[model samples]
Target: MVGTAAQHFVAVHGVGHGAWVYYKVKPRMEAAGVRFTPVSLAAAGNNGKKLEEVRSLHDYTTPLLEVLAAVPAGEKVVLVGHSGGGYPAAYAMEKFPEKISVAVFVNALMPDTKNRPSYVIDEYLARTPPEAWMDTQFPTYGDPPITALVVGPKFISDSLYNLSPVEDQALGHLSVRPGSLFMEDLATMDKFSDDKFGSVRRAYIVAADDKTIPAEFQRWLIENNPVAEVKEIKGADHMPMFTQPDALCKCLLEIAQKHAA
Candidate 1:
Protein backbone atom coordinates (compact mmCIF):
# COMPACT_ATOMS: atom_id res chain seq x y z
CA MET A 1 0.00 0.00 0.00
CA VAL A 2 1.22 3.53 -0.67
CA GLY A 3 2.24 5.13 2.60
CA THR A 4 -0.50 7.45 3.87
CA ALA A 5 1.62 10.61 4.02
CA ALA A 6 2.43 13.19 1.34
CA GLN A 7 0.57 11.74 -1.67
CA HIS A 8 -0.74 13.92 -4.51
CA PHE A 9 -4.06 13.29 -6.25
CA VAL A 10 -5.84 15.05 -9.14
CA ALA A 11 -9.63 14.95 -8.93
CA VAL A 12 -11.53 15.30 -12.24
CA HIS A 13 -15.27 15.55 -12.45
CA GLY A 14 -17.21 13.44 -14.91
CA VAL A 15 -19.88 15.86 -16.16
CA GLY A 16 -21.43 18.40 -13.82
CA HIS A 17 -18.96 18.87 -11.01
CA GLY A 18 -16.50 21.58 -11.62
CA ALA A 19 -13.74 21.66 -9.00
CA TRP A 20 -16.33 22.02 -6.26
CA VAL A 21 -17.30 18.38 -6.00
CA TYR A 22 -14.10 17.96 -4.11
CA TYR A 23 -15.35 20.35 -1.49
CA LYS A 24 -16.79 17.31 0.27
CA VAL A 25 -14.00 15.04 -0.99
CA LYS A 26 -10.73 16.96 -0.44
CA PRO A 27 -11.12 17.23 3.33
CA ARG A 28 -11.29 13.48 3.80
CA MET A 29 -8.06 12.93 1.92
CA GLU A 30 -6.38 15.88 3.64
CA ALA A 31 -7.51 14.54 7.00
CA ALA A 32 -5.62 11.43 5.95
CA GLY A 33 -2.62 13.62 5.03
CA VAL A 34 -3.13 13.56 1.28
CA ARG A 35 -2.64 16.50 -1.06
CA PHE A 36 -5.26 16.62 -3.83
CA THR A 37 -6.23 19.13 -6.55
CA PRO A 38 -9.71 19.30 -8.05
CA VAL A 39 -10.34 20.83 -11.50
CA SER A 40 -13.37 21.85 -13.58
CA LEU A 41 -13.99 21.86 -17.31
CA ALA A 42 -14.23 25.32 -18.95
CA ALA A 43 -17.86 25.88 -18.09
CA ALA A 44 -18.21 23.50 -15.18
CA GLY A 45 -18.39 24.33 -11.46
CA ASN A 46 -18.68 28.02 -10.72
CA ASN A 47 -17.24 29.08 -14.04
CA GLY A 48 -20.41 30.93 -15.09
CA LYS A 49 -20.52 28.86 -18.25
CA LYS A 50 -23.31 26.67 -19.56
CA LEU A 51 -22.93 23.06 -20.73
CA GLU A 52 -24.09 24.09 -24.21
CA GLU A 53 -21.18 26.49 -24.51
CA VAL A 54 -18.49 23.84 -24.76
CA ARG A 55 -17.68 23.27 -28.43
CA SER A 56 -15.00 20.60 -28.43
CA LEU A 57 -12.70 18.37 -26.37
CA HIS A 58 -10.43 21.35 -25.82
CA ASP A 59 -13.11 23.06 -23.81
CA TYR A 60 -13.55 20.02 -21.57
CA THR A 61 -9.82 19.96 -21.04
CA THR A 62 -9.31 23.61 -20.19
CA PRO A 63 -9.35 23.32 -16.41
CA LEU A 64 -7.45 20.05 -16.35
CA LEU A 65 -4.76 21.23 -18.75
CA GLU A 66 -4.18 24.23 -16.52
CA VAL A 67 -3.45 21.82 -13.72
CA LEU A 68 -1.15 19.76 -15.90
CA ALA A 69 0.77 22.84 -17.01
CA ALA A 70 1.23 23.89 -13.41
CA VAL A 71 3.02 20.62 -12.61
CA PRO A 72 6.80 20.61 -12.73
CA ALA A 73 8.35 19.09 -15.84
CA GLY A 74 9.28 15.72 -14.31
CA GLU A 75 6.42 15.32 -11.83
CA LYS A 76 3.56 12.94 -12.65
CA VAL A 77 0.06 13.24 -11.21
CA VAL A 78 -2.50 10.73 -10.00
CA LEU A 79 -5.63 11.31 -12.13
CA VAL A 80 -9.15 10.77 -10.74
CA GLY A 81 -11.87 11.19 -13.38
CA HIS A 82 -15.59 11.16 -12.86
CA SER A 83 -18.12 10.79 -15.76
CA GLY A 84 -16.77 12.41 -18.93
CA GLY A 85 -13.69 13.73 -17.20
CA GLY A 86 -12.06 10.45 -18.15
CA TYR A 87 -11.62 11.66 -21.72
CA PRO A 88 -9.34 14.58 -20.96
CA ALA A 89 -7.57 12.63 -18.27
CA ALA A 90 -6.82 10.00 -20.89
CA TYR A 91 -5.88 12.73 -23.29
CA ALA A 92 -3.56 14.19 -20.68
CA MET A 93 -2.01 10.80 -20.15
CA GLU A 94 -1.33 10.49 -23.83
CA LYS A 95 0.19 13.94 -24.08
CA PHE A 96 2.27 13.92 -20.91
CA PRO A 97 2.96 10.31 -20.07
CA GLU A 98 5.70 11.26 -17.63
CA LYS A 99 3.45 13.72 -15.82
CA ILE A 100 0.77 11.16 -14.93
CA SER A 101 1.26 9.06 -11.79
CA VAL A 102 -1.87 6.90 -12.22
CA ALA A 103 -5.54 6.99 -13.17
CA VAL A 104 -8.75 6.32 -11.21
CA PHE A 105 -11.96 5.99 -13.23
CA VAL A 106 -15.03 6.49 -11.05
CA ASN A 107 -18.60 5.62 -12.10
CA ALA A 108 -17.21 7.14 -15.24
CA LEU A 109 -17.84 6.61 -18.91
CA MET A 110 -14.46 5.25 -19.92
CA PRO A 111 -13.13 5.32 -23.47
CA ASP A 112 -10.70 3.05 -25.26
CA THR A 113 -7.17 4.32 -25.83
CA LYS A 114 -7.70 4.41 -29.59
CA ASN A 115 -11.44 4.76 -29.71
CA ARG A 116 -13.34 8.02 -29.87
CA PRO A 117 -15.27 9.13 -26.78
CA SER A 118 -18.44 7.93 -28.58
CA TYR A 119 -17.53 4.25 -28.23
CA VAL A 120 -18.38 4.29 -24.52
CA ILE A 121 -22.07 4.78 -25.30
CA ASP A 122 -22.04 3.17 -28.74
CA GLU A 123 -22.19 -0.28 -27.20
CA TYR A 124 -25.48 0.56 -25.56
CA LEU A 125 -26.92 1.96 -28.77
CA ALA A 126 -25.96 -1.36 -30.32
CA ARG A 127 -27.04 -3.38 -27.26
CA THR A 128 -29.59 -6.08 -28.00
CA PRO A 129 -31.23 -5.40 -24.66
CA PRO A 130 -31.22 -1.65 -25.28
CA GLU A 131 -30.53 0.90 -22.56
CA ALA A 132 -33.49 2.62 -20.96
CA TRP A 133 -31.23 4.81 -18.90
CA MET A 134 -31.54 7.87 -21.19
CA ASP A 135 -34.40 9.92 -22.50
CA THR A 136 -35.33 10.12 -26.21
CA GLN A 137 -32.15 12.10 -26.78
CA PHE A 138 -29.78 14.02 -24.55
CA PRO A 139 -31.04 17.30 -23.24
CA THR A 140 -30.01 20.14 -25.52
CA TYR A 141 -28.26 23.16 -24.09
CA GLY A 142 -25.58 25.56 -25.37
CA ASP A 143 -22.53 24.57 -27.44
CA PRO A 144 -21.21 21.33 -25.96
CA PRO A 145 -17.94 19.45 -26.16
CA ILE A 146 -19.30 15.96 -25.57
CA THR A 147 -23.00 15.52 -25.26
CA ALA A 148 -23.57 16.17 -21.56
CA LEU A 149 -26.37 13.76 -20.69
CA VAL A 150 -27.65 13.25 -17.16
CA VAL A 151 -29.36 9.85 -16.75
CA GLY A 152 -30.80 10.06 -13.27
CA PRO A 153 -32.01 7.19 -11.04
CA LYS A 154 -35.66 7.61 -11.99
CA PHE A 155 -34.86 6.80 -15.58
CA ILE A 156 -32.54 3.88 -14.78
CA SER A 157 -34.21 2.40 -11.66
CA ASP A 158 -33.01 1.27 -8.20
CA SER A 159 -31.21 -1.93 -9.16
CA LEU A 160 -28.72 -0.15 -11.39
CA TYR A 161 -28.75 2.84 -9.04
CA ASN A 162 -28.79 0.91 -5.76
CA LEU A 163 -25.13 1.74 -5.18
CA SER A 164 -25.79 5.50 -5.35
CA PRO A 165 -26.64 7.20 -2.06
CA VAL A 166 -29.85 9.15 -1.74
CA GLU A 167 -27.95 12.08 -0.32
CA ASP A 168 -26.14 12.52 -3.64
CA GLN A 169 -29.36 12.84 -5.57
CA ALA A 170 -30.67 15.25 -2.98
CA LEU A 171 -27.68 17.52 -3.56
CA GLY A 172 -28.49 17.78 -7.26
CA HIS A 173 -24.89 18.75 -7.86
CA LEU A 174 -24.02 16.45 -10.73
CA SER A 175 -25.93 17.76 -13.72
CA VAL A 176 -23.34 18.47 -16.41
CA ARG A 177 -25.11 16.15 -18.91
CA PRO A 178 -22.79 14.55 -21.48
CA GLY A 179 -23.69 14.58 -25.14
CA SER A 180 -23.15 11.31 -27.01
CA LEU A 181 -22.74 12.31 -30.65
CA PHE A 182 -19.85 14.77 -30.92
CA MET A 183 -18.12 13.72 -27.73
CA GLU A 184 -18.09 10.02 -28.56
CA ASP A 185 -16.73 10.80 -32.01
CA LEU A 186 -13.70 12.46 -30.41
CA ALA A 187 -12.41 9.08 -29.23
CA THR A 188 -12.01 7.71 -32.77
CA MET A 189 -8.40 8.81 -33.29
CA ASP A 190 -5.68 8.40 -30.72
CA LYS A 191 -4.19 11.79 -31.55
CA PHE A 192 -2.82 11.96 -28.03
CA SER A 193 -0.99 8.61 -27.90
CA ASP A 194 2.80 8.37 -27.96
CA ASP A 195 5.45 6.05 -26.48
CA LYS A 196 5.36 7.81 -23.13
CA PHE A 197 1.60 7.46 -22.70
CA GLY A 198 -0.94 4.63 -23.32
CA SER A 199 0.40 2.41 -20.50
CA VAL A 200 0.13 4.41 -17.29
CA ARG A 201 -0.98 2.75 -14.05
CA ARG A 202 -4.79 2.71 -14.07
CA ALA A 203 -7.77 1.67 -11.90
CA TYR A 204 -11.58 1.70 -12.18
CA ILE A 205 -14.22 1.98 -9.47
CA VAL A 206 -17.50 0.26 -10.35
CA ALA A 207 -20.61 1.86 -8.90
CA ALA A 208 -23.11 -0.94 -8.28
CA ASP A 209 -26.07 1.41 -8.15
CA ASP A 210 -25.15 3.45 -11.16
CA LYS A 211 -28.15 3.45 -13.47
CA THR A 212 -26.62 5.91 -15.88
CA ILE A 213 -23.72 3.60 -16.76
CA PRO A 214 -24.42 0.22 -15.19
CA ALA A 215 -21.81 -2.20 -13.83
CA GLU A 216 -21.85 -4.23 -17.03
CA PHE A 217 -20.95 -1.16 -19.04
CA GLN A 218 -18.29 -0.25 -16.51
CA ARG A 219 -16.86 -3.75 -16.92
CA TRP A 220 -16.68 -3.27 -20.66
CA LEU A 221 -14.94 0.07 -20.12
CA ILE A 222 -12.34 -1.45 -17.80
CA GLU A 223 -11.74 -4.35 -20.18
CA ASN A 224 -11.07 -2.03 -23.08
CA ASN A 225 -8.90 0.37 -21.10
CA PRO A 226 -5.50 -0.64 -19.72
CA VAL A 227 -6.25 -0.93 -16.01
CA ALA A 228 -4.23 -2.51 -13.19
CA GLU A 229 -6.98 -2.55 -10.53
CA VAL A 230 -10.76 -2.67 -10.58
CA LYS A 231 -12.67 -1.85 -7.38
CA GLU A 232 -16.38 -2.57 -7.09
CA ILE A 233 -18.35 -0.19 -4.90
CA LYS A 234 -21.62 -1.63 -3.70
CA GLY A 235 -24.68 0.47 -2.75
CA ALA A 236 -23.25 3.59 -4.36
CA ASP A 237 -24.85 4.92 -7.48
CA HIS A 238 -23.71 7.05 -10.42
CA MET A 239 -22.73 10.08 -8.34
CA PRO A 240 -20.37 8.86 -5.63
CA MET A 241 -18.92 12.35 -5.23
CA PHE A 242 -22.16 13.25 -3.53
CA THR A 243 -23.15 9.91 -2.05
CA GLN A 244 -19.82 8.42 -0.95
CA PRO A 245 -16.97 10.89 -0.92
CA ASP A 246 -14.83 8.86 1.47
CA ALA A 247 -15.23 5.69 -0.53
CA LEU A 248 -14.11 7.59 -3.60
CA CYS A 249 -11.29 9.16 -1.63
CA LYS A 250 -10.15 5.80 -0.29
CA CYS A 251 -10.09 4.27 -3.73
CA LEU A 252 -8.12 7.22 -5.11
CA LEU A 253 -5.62 7.07 -2.24
CA GLU A 254 -5.17 3.35 -2.70
CA ILE A 255 -4.61 3.67 -6.43
CA ALA A 256 -2.08 6.45 -5.86
CA GLN A 257 -0.26 4.25 -3.35
CA LYS A 258 -0.32 1.30 -5.70
CA HIS A 259 1.22 3.40 -8.44
CA ALA A 260 3.78 4.92 -6.09
CA ALA A 261 4.98 1.44 -5.26
Candidate 2:
Protein backbone atom coordinates (compact mmCIF):
# COMPACT_ATOMS: atom_id res chain seq x y z
CA MET A 1 0.00 0.00 0.00
CA VAL A 2 3.00 2.30 -0.44
CA GLY A 3 2.05 5.56 -2.08
CA THR A 4 3.86 6.73 -5.22
CA ALA A 5 5.69 9.40 -3.23
CA ALA A 6 6.71 6.84 -0.62
CA GLN A 7 8.68 4.59 -2.93
CA HIS A 8 11.72 3.40 -0.98
CA PHE A 9 14.58 1.15 -2.02
CA VAL A 10 16.47 -0.79 0.62
CA ALA A 11 19.68 -2.42 -0.54
CA VAL A 12 21.30 -5.41 1.19
CA HIS A 13 24.93 -6.12 0.35
CA GLY A 14 26.57 -9.51 -0.16
CA VAL A 15 29.35 -11.23 1.82
CA GLY A 16 32.52 -9.38 2.72
CA HIS A 17 30.73 -6.18 1.60
CA GLY A 18 28.81 -3.52 3.46
CA ALA A 19 26.41 -0.76 2.55
CA TRP A 20 29.30 0.86 0.72
CA VAL A 21 28.78 -1.45 -2.24
CA TYR A 22 25.73 0.55 -3.22
CA TYR A 23 27.45 3.93 -3.11
CA LYS A 24 27.64 4.12 -6.87
CA VAL A 25 23.95 3.45 -7.31
CA LYS A 26 22.55 5.37 -4.35
CA PRO A 27 22.84 8.81 -5.87
CA ARG A 28 21.32 7.66 -9.11
CA MET A 29 18.34 6.12 -7.33
CA GLU A 30 17.76 9.21 -5.22
CA ALA A 31 18.00 11.47 -8.26
CA ALA A 32 15.13 9.50 -9.72
CA GLY A 33 13.01 10.53 -6.70
CA VAL A 34 13.38 7.17 -4.98
CA ARG A 35 14.48 6.97 -1.36
CA PHE A 36 17.46 4.59 -1.14
CA THR A 37 18.71 3.05 2.07
CA PRO A 38 21.78 0.83 2.11
CA VAL A 39 22.39 -1.20 5.24
CA SER A 40 25.65 -2.48 6.74
CA LEU A 41 25.18 -5.97 8.08
CA ALA A 42 26.69 -6.87 11.43
CA ALA A 43 30.52 -6.87 11.27
CA ALA A 44 30.47 -5.59 7.73
CA GLY A 45 31.53 -2.07 6.65
CA ASN A 46 31.74 0.36 9.52
CA ASN A 47 29.44 -1.63 11.78
CA GLY A 48 31.24 -1.90 15.13
CA LYS A 49 30.36 -5.54 15.70
CA LYS A 50 33.24 -7.98 15.38
CA LEU A 51 33.11 -11.02 13.16
CA GLU A 52 32.87 -13.32 16.17
CA GLU A 53 29.95 -11.34 17.56
CA VAL A 54 27.72 -12.22 14.61
CA ARG A 55 27.40 -15.90 15.46
CA SER A 56 24.06 -16.62 13.82
CA LEU A 57 21.86 -15.67 10.90
CA HIS A 58 19.65 -13.67 13.25
CA ASP A 59 22.62 -11.68 14.47
CA TYR A 60 23.67 -10.79 10.95
CA THR A 61 20.19 -9.81 9.90
CA THR A 62 19.31 -7.55 12.81
CA PRO A 63 20.06 -4.30 11.04
CA LEU A 64 17.90 -5.09 8.02
CA LEU A 65 15.03 -6.40 10.12
CA GLU A 66 15.18 -3.27 12.26
CA VAL A 67 15.01 -1.12 9.15
CA LEU A 68 11.93 -2.91 7.91
CA ALA A 69 10.31 -2.81 11.32
CA ALA A 70 10.60 0.98 11.33
CA VAL A 71 8.73 1.52 8.10
CA PRO A 72 5.58 3.63 8.61
CA ALA A 73 2.25 1.88 8.50
CA GLY A 74 0.82 1.46 4.99
CA GLU A 75 4.24 2.14 3.41
CA LYS A 76 6.49 -0.51 1.81
CA VAL A 77 10.04 -0.83 0.57
CA VAL A 78 11.56 -2.52 -2.42
CA LEU A 79 14.21 -4.82 -0.94
CA VAL A 80 17.18 -5.62 -3.14
CA GLY A 81 19.76 -8.22 -2.18
CA HIS A 82 23.04 -8.84 -3.92
CA SER A 83 25.29 -11.93 -3.76
CA GLY A 84 25.14 -13.73 -0.41
CA GLY A 85 23.07 -10.86 0.96
CA GLY A 86 19.97 -12.59 -0.35
CA TYR A 87 19.93 -14.76 2.77
CA PRO A 88 19.30 -11.94 5.21
CA ALA A 89 16.92 -10.24 2.80
CA ALA A 90 14.93 -13.45 2.53
CA TYR A 91 14.85 -13.70 6.30
CA ALA A 92 13.52 -10.15 6.52
CA MET A 93 10.97 -10.87 3.83
CA GLU A 94 9.71 -13.79 5.87
CA LYS A 95 9.62 -11.76 9.04
CA PHE A 96 7.97 -8.69 7.53
CA PRO A 97 6.23 -9.61 4.32
CA GLU A 98 3.82 -6.72 4.63
CA LYS A 99 6.64 -4.19 4.73
CA ILE A 100 8.18 -5.32 1.45
CA SER A 101 6.70 -4.52 -1.93
CA VAL A 102 9.05 -6.90 -3.70
CA ALA A 103 12.23 -8.86 -3.01
CA VAL A 104 14.80 -8.46 -5.78
CA PHE A 105 17.72 -10.88 -5.84
CA VAL A 106 20.63 -9.56 -7.90
CA ASN A 107 22.73 -12.59 -8.71
CA ALA A 108 21.98 -13.56 -5.13
CA LEU A 109 21.16 -16.76 -3.24
CA MET A 110 17.38 -16.78 -3.49
CA PRO A 111 15.88 -19.45 -1.20
CA ASP A 112 12.78 -21.62 -1.43
CA THR A 113 10.22 -22.65 1.15
CA LYS A 114 10.83 -26.37 0.45
CA ASN A 115 14.40 -26.45 1.78
CA ARG A 116 16.39 -25.21 4.74
CA PRO A 117 17.45 -21.55 4.47
CA SER A 118 21.05 -22.66 3.96
CA TYR A 119 20.22 -24.73 0.88
CA VAL A 120 21.15 -21.93 -1.53
CA ILE A 121 24.46 -21.36 0.20
CA ASP A 122 25.13 -25.09 0.19
CA GLU A 123 24.30 -25.28 -3.49
CA TYR A 124 26.57 -22.31 -4.21
CA LEU A 125 29.46 -23.88 -2.33
CA ALA A 126 28.89 -27.11 -4.17
CA ARG A 127 28.98 -25.28 -7.48
CA THR A 128 32.07 -23.34 -6.42
CA PRO A 129 34.41 -25.61 -4.55
CA PRO A 130 36.86 -24.48 -1.87
CA GLU A 131 39.70 -24.56 -4.35
CA ALA A 132 37.81 -22.09 -6.48
CA TRP A 133 37.87 -19.61 -3.60
CA MET A 134 41.39 -18.70 -4.70
CA ASP A 135 43.16 -16.59 -2.06
CA THR A 136 39.97 -15.84 -0.10
CA GLN A 137 40.52 -16.43 3.58
CA PHE A 138 38.22 -18.51 5.77
CA PRO A 139 38.93 -17.55 9.36
CA THR A 140 37.11 -19.23 12.20
CA TYR A 141 36.17 -17.67 15.52
CA GLY A 142 34.12 -18.25 18.69
CA ASP A 143 34.10 -21.46 20.78
CA PRO A 144 31.84 -23.21 18.30
CA PRO A 145 34.15 -22.17 15.46
CA ILE A 146 32.13 -19.73 13.42
CA THR A 147 33.78 -19.27 10.02
CA ALA A 148 33.96 -16.00 8.10
CA LEU A 149 35.16 -15.37 4.58
CA VAL A 150 37.50 -12.45 3.91
CA VAL A 151 37.74 -11.85 0.21
CA GLY A 152 41.36 -11.67 -0.97
CA PRO A 153 42.61 -9.11 -3.43
CA LYS A 154 43.10 -11.74 -6.07
CA PHE A 155 39.62 -13.10 -5.59
CA ILE A 156 38.24 -9.58 -5.58
CA SER A 157 39.98 -8.76 -8.84
CA ASP A 158 39.30 -12.02 -10.60
CA SER A 159 35.90 -13.07 -9.44
CA LEU A 160 34.07 -10.13 -7.88
CA TYR A 161 35.32 -6.89 -9.39
CA ASN A 162 36.58 -8.18 -12.71
CA LEU A 163 34.57 -5.73 -14.76
CA SER A 164 34.87 -2.80 -12.36
CA PRO A 165 37.31 0.06 -12.50
CA VAL A 166 40.74 -0.21 -10.89
CA GLU A 167 39.80 2.45 -8.33
CA ASP A 168 36.56 0.70 -7.34
CA GLN A 169 38.42 -2.62 -7.27
CA ALA A 170 40.94 -1.09 -4.92
CA LEU A 171 38.13 0.30 -2.81
CA GLY A 172 36.70 -3.21 -2.45
CA HIS A 173 40.09 -4.63 -1.50
CA LEU A 174 40.50 -1.97 1.15
CA SER A 175 37.01 -1.94 2.63
CA VAL A 176 35.74 -5.48 2.33
CA ARG A 177 35.40 -7.21 5.70
CA PRO A 178 35.10 -10.75 7.00
CA GLY A 179 31.55 -12.12 6.54
CA SER A 180 30.03 -15.37 7.69
CA LEU A 181 27.48 -17.45 5.84
CA PHE A 182 26.18 -18.73 9.19
CA MET A 183 25.35 -22.04 7.58
CA GLU A 184 24.99 -23.84 10.90
CA ASP A 185 22.45 -21.34 12.20
CA LEU A 186 20.60 -21.31 8.90
CA ALA A 187 20.41 -25.10 8.88
CA THR A 188 18.69 -25.05 12.26
CA MET A 189 16.39 -22.14 11.49
CA ASP A 190 12.87 -22.72 10.29
CA LYS A 191 12.29 -22.76 6.56
CA PHE A 192 10.67 -19.73 4.84
CA SER A 193 6.93 -20.16 4.34
CA ASP A 194 4.80 -19.76 1.23
CA ASP A 195 2.42 -17.48 3.07
CA LYS A 196 5.10 -15.19 4.48
CA PHE A 197 8.16 -14.94 2.20
CA GLY A 198 6.29 -16.28 -0.82
CA SER A 199 3.54 -13.71 -0.48
CA VAL A 200 5.94 -10.95 -1.53
CA ARG A 201 6.64 -10.54 -5.24
CA ARG A 202 10.17 -11.69 -6.23
CA ALA A 203 12.52 -10.73 -9.06
CA TYR A 204 16.02 -11.74 -10.13
CA ILE A 205 18.67 -9.64 -11.83
CA VAL A 206 21.32 -11.59 -13.74
CA ALA A 207 24.81 -10.14 -13.82
CA ALA A 208 25.78 -11.68 -17.10
CA ASP A 209 29.56 -11.72 -16.87
CA ASP A 210 29.93 -12.51 -13.19
CA LYS A 211 32.66 -15.00 -12.34
CA THR A 212 31.88 -15.18 -8.62
CA ILE A 213 28.38 -16.58 -9.19
CA PRO A 214 28.57 -17.54 -12.82
CA ALA A 215 25.67 -17.04 -15.22
CA GLU A 216 24.92 -20.76 -15.17
CA PHE A 217 24.51 -20.85 -11.39
CA GLN A 218 22.41 -17.68 -11.54
CA ARG A 219 20.14 -19.34 -14.07
CA TRP A 220 19.98 -22.44 -11.90
CA LEU A 221 18.79 -20.31 -8.97
CA ILE A 222 16.04 -18.85 -11.11
CA GLU A 223 14.99 -22.27 -12.39
CA ASN A 224 14.87 -23.70 -8.90
CA ASN A 225 12.79 -20.89 -7.32
CA PRO A 226 10.80 -19.06 -9.92
CA VAL A 227 10.25 -15.28 -9.55
CA ALA A 228 7.69 -12.80 -10.84
CA GLU A 229 10.26 -11.35 -13.25
CA VAL A 230 13.86 -11.81 -14.41
CA LYS A 231 16.09 -8.90 -15.46
CA GLU A 232 19.53 -9.04 -17.02
CA ILE A 233 22.46 -6.61 -17.08
CA LYS A 234 24.49 -7.66 -20.07
CA GLY A 235 28.32 -7.73 -19.80
CA ALA A 236 28.10 -6.98 -16.09
CA ASP A 237 30.19 -8.78 -13.48
CA HIS A 238 29.36 -9.62 -9.89
CA MET A 239 29.89 -6.00 -8.83
CA PRO A 240 27.37 -4.56 -11.19
CA MET A 241 26.90 -1.47 -9.04
CA PHE A 242 30.49 -0.59 -9.81
CA THR A 243 30.77 -2.11 -13.28
CA GLN A 244 27.42 -1.07 -14.70
CA PRO A 245 25.84 1.43 -12.36
CA ASP A 246 23.74 3.02 -15.07
CA ALA A 247 22.19 -0.23 -16.17
CA LEU A 248 21.80 -1.41 -12.59
CA CYS A 249 20.13 1.85 -11.58
CA LYS A 250 17.87 1.71 -14.60
CA CYS A 251 16.69 -1.76 -13.74
CA LEU A 252 16.14 -0.85 -10.10
CA LEU A 253 14.17 2.30 -10.96
CA GLU A 254 12.03 0.41 -13.39
CA ILE A 255 11.48 -2.36 -10.91
CA ALA A 256 10.50 0.11 -8.21
CA GLN A 257 8.01 1.71 -10.56
CA LYS A 258 6.45 -1.59 -11.51
CA HIS A 259 6.57 -3.31 -8.13
CA ALA A 260 6.82 -0.71 -5.37
CA ALA A 261 4.41 1.85 -6.72
| Candidate with best lDDT | 2
TM-score between candidate 1 and the true structure: 0.81
TM-score of 2: 0.96
**Which candidate has the top score in TM-score?**
2
The CA lDDT of each predicted structure is: 0.67, 0.89
Error of 1 at 18 (Å): 2.5
Every model: Cα RMSD to truth: 3.5, 2.1
lDDT of 1 at 80: 84
TM-score of each: 0.81, 0.96
lDDT of 2 by residue, 1-261 (tens): 122456888999999899999998988887777788999999898889988788898899999999999999888899999999999999999999999999899999899999888888888888887777899988888888877788888999988998899999999989998898998788888889999998999999999999999999999999999998899999899999999998998888777778766
